[model samples]
Target: MAMSPEQPSAPRRSRIALWLVLLLLLALGGYAGWHQWRAREQAVVNSTQQQVDALSERLNAMRTEQRAQARRLQQADSLNRVLRDELDGITQRAALLETSVERLADPDRHGAQALRLDETEMLLTIGSQRLQIAGDLDGARRAYALAAGVLDGIDDPAYLSLRQTLLQERTALDALGADPRVRAIAQLDAYTQTVTAPAGREERARDERAPWWQRAFGNLLQVQPTDRAVAVQAADRAAALAGLQLEISLARAAAERRDTAGYRDALRRADTWLQRLAPDSAARTQQRAQLQALAALPLSLSVPTLGSTLQQLRQLRAR
Candidate 1:
């Protein structure tokens, strides 16, 4: 077993070579694992960097949009302020114009002459309305008189001609005569009385001496001179009389309103009722003539120079 030291050194050399080969294999494996880990770490870093860059870009875009919206809002606010200023200016100008107009129309600036002129104009206008609208002749005359008195208080030479015109208008108004309605109403009353009065003894005697055939048929029929048959029943006569009274009342109302056409039409209807109420005779004809006269009466005055004074006054005021 102790044969030679050379044999022992040879075995030792073989063992050392085997140990070196195992060390070399371990180093190569460690190097490969480190390289693979480094590659994986580098890929993760690159992916994380890409995500951060995308987030930064989006943040920049948001900032830009926010700035643009802020600028637009500022512009809108400026426009609103400008519009408000313009509206305020317009309101101020309108108020100034109204104040100026009111100052111009103020009556205190013109003294007594202006007051008189204003009164005259108002009275004249009142008179015109009363005459034309309400058919108030007395009221119109009173207004005209007061207007004349007020106008007389004005000593201005320029208004002298206005007085003359006013006088002329008043004169024309006076010349229209009495109210036709009054005369018409009187005539109607007389007509009603004459028609409604009971017949005299002579008429009763004539009826008693009538022919036998006429007397027999008298209760059934009454032949008028116009060849119209009339009913003899008391109820029918009463009904006709009531209709006549109604028509007369209508005519009277129309006259009060100064409705000329309506007045005439009502009178004509009343005449028709009268024909039924009264038998045809000289008295009936006379009654019809009177009714026609009343129907022809004028309810309103036609004065062409009615508002001449007012027109002249306005012209002077304008000057």
Candidate 2:
């Protein structure tokens, strides 16, 4: 059995071949396992990178939200400060106004003076209304004098000027003279007394001047020239007198209402009636002259400074 080294036995050769095949198989298996492990590691790294990107996007969004909330909070804090300052200013103003009111409030002496001023004002207003609207001169004068008395009673030195104003108003009122309506009424009364008197003498004189034949027929049928003034008929004499009286009454009413035009017109109408009633009488001429004079009288009292005292009083009270 000791064969040469070059020519080995058959079993030994077979065993050598099997050992080489096994070694080759073990090397191939080790390479395959290493390739699989590298592939797995690469997959794990890709997944980790994707997760990190997602986390970064979420954190940025959260940071942006936080910044916006902080800005809104700052704006809200500034607005609250401004509102608080305004409220404090308003409260201070209210307190100052209340203090000023408390310092100026007075109820005793101020109340009395205020009452006097009110009375004076009321009296002045009544006087003005009486003169302008009702044309009651006497009533207006009385009211003005009473207003003066009330104004004088006010002892406030600040209102000393008001006394002078009221006095001037009184002086102006006194200077207006007597009411023309009073004179007109007196004249009318005198005229009316004469109007009711008989026209017997005038009629007899006219009859005596007529022709004898005309006079004989005068009782039955009177005839006169058309150019001559027509006398009121005997049957209508009462009504004519009544119309004349009504005209005079109308004139009086117009004067009372301060209607200058209507007063003049009514007086003119009365004069016309007077002409009809007693055309040739001396009394008629005199009465007509009186009516003309009465018509010339102005019923309205125009004074630019009439209500100056009242205006001054009101201004003082306002102050």
Candidate 3:
């Protein structure tokens, strides 16, 4: 039997309703997908902002560190200037001391001992001033120690002893701190004993066998010279030694401060001095030995004062 038109139309309407429902569902799904995509995009933007902030902070930290390093370099330069000025003053004082010592040894100067004592006193005063200027407690203490030693060696009973017997006196004077008094006294006693004692057996034997007139001439020429060449050579040697001493002091200061450039410059100067002082092969070998000794020392050793520096320099030359 053939179906009625009404029945067929009803089936078609039901199919249309199903199609409408499917279309609605598809629209809802599209909206949900779009919302999810927008949320993901927002999350990506937030992450990017956080990364940018972190980079900016890192850049700022680097800049701050750079500025701090620059400041430290400037401080190092200032320290160098102070050191140079102190060294210049010390050099001047050393020259004066050398002249005084030379004069005191002269036979023509009858009151040479008294003059030497006075010169020693002056040197002590100058050393005190330099220590104050340097602003280094260790240096000041060393200078005071040296001064005390010189004072103790004075044979004159009137200046035999200091008013400040105890370490308290040094503290009151503000010349040297209290800690170095015992050490200074000990050093002074040792130095005095050595200076007053006679020559060693070897030295005495060498002196007895040595040519009298030639040796006398050499000794006299050191202070009272008739020959120009001998005097010139002696003067040149003294000058060179003085320069080497200065270089050694500078190197010591550089090492103490941990300034690589300053240390290198001082080392080069020391090497140059060694080269200049060594005229012959034997002397060169001797100088090389001295240089090696110095090189072997750690680069961080402290040199407190000019006197200490001079002592070290003498040790190097003796080697």
What TM-score, computed on C-alpha atoms, does each candidate reach?
Answer: 0.60, 0.56, 0.31
> lDDT tens string, model 3, 55-92?
99999999999999999999999999999999999999
On TM-score, the candidate that comes out on top is 1
lDDT score for residue 208 of model 1:
85
**Against the true structure, candidate 2 has what lDDT?**
0.79
Q: So what's the TM-score on candidate 1? A: 0.60
* Residue-level lDDT tens digits of model 1 in 1-319: 5775555578898999999998899899899999999999999999999999999999999999999999999999999999999999999999998876775677744556776788999999999999888777788999999999998888777778888999999999898766566767777677666655543343456668989998788778865556664434556767777887888889888877778898899989988877876567897798789889889977776889988999999998877
The TM-score, computed over Cα atoms with residue i paired to residue i, of candidate 3 is 0.31
Q: Output the number of the lDDT-best candidate.
A: 1
For candidate 2, lDDT tens digit of each residue in 1-319?
7875687889998999999998899899988889888888888899989999999999999999999999999999999999999999999999998865654475534656667788999999999998888777788899999998887787879888889888888888888777766766677667666655555455657668989987777668866667645464555555667778899889888877778899899989987777776656576777788779878987777656778988998897666
The predictions' CA RMSDs to the true structure, in order, are 9.8, 16.0, 26.3
RMSD of 2: 16.0
> Residue 277 lDDT in model 1?
62
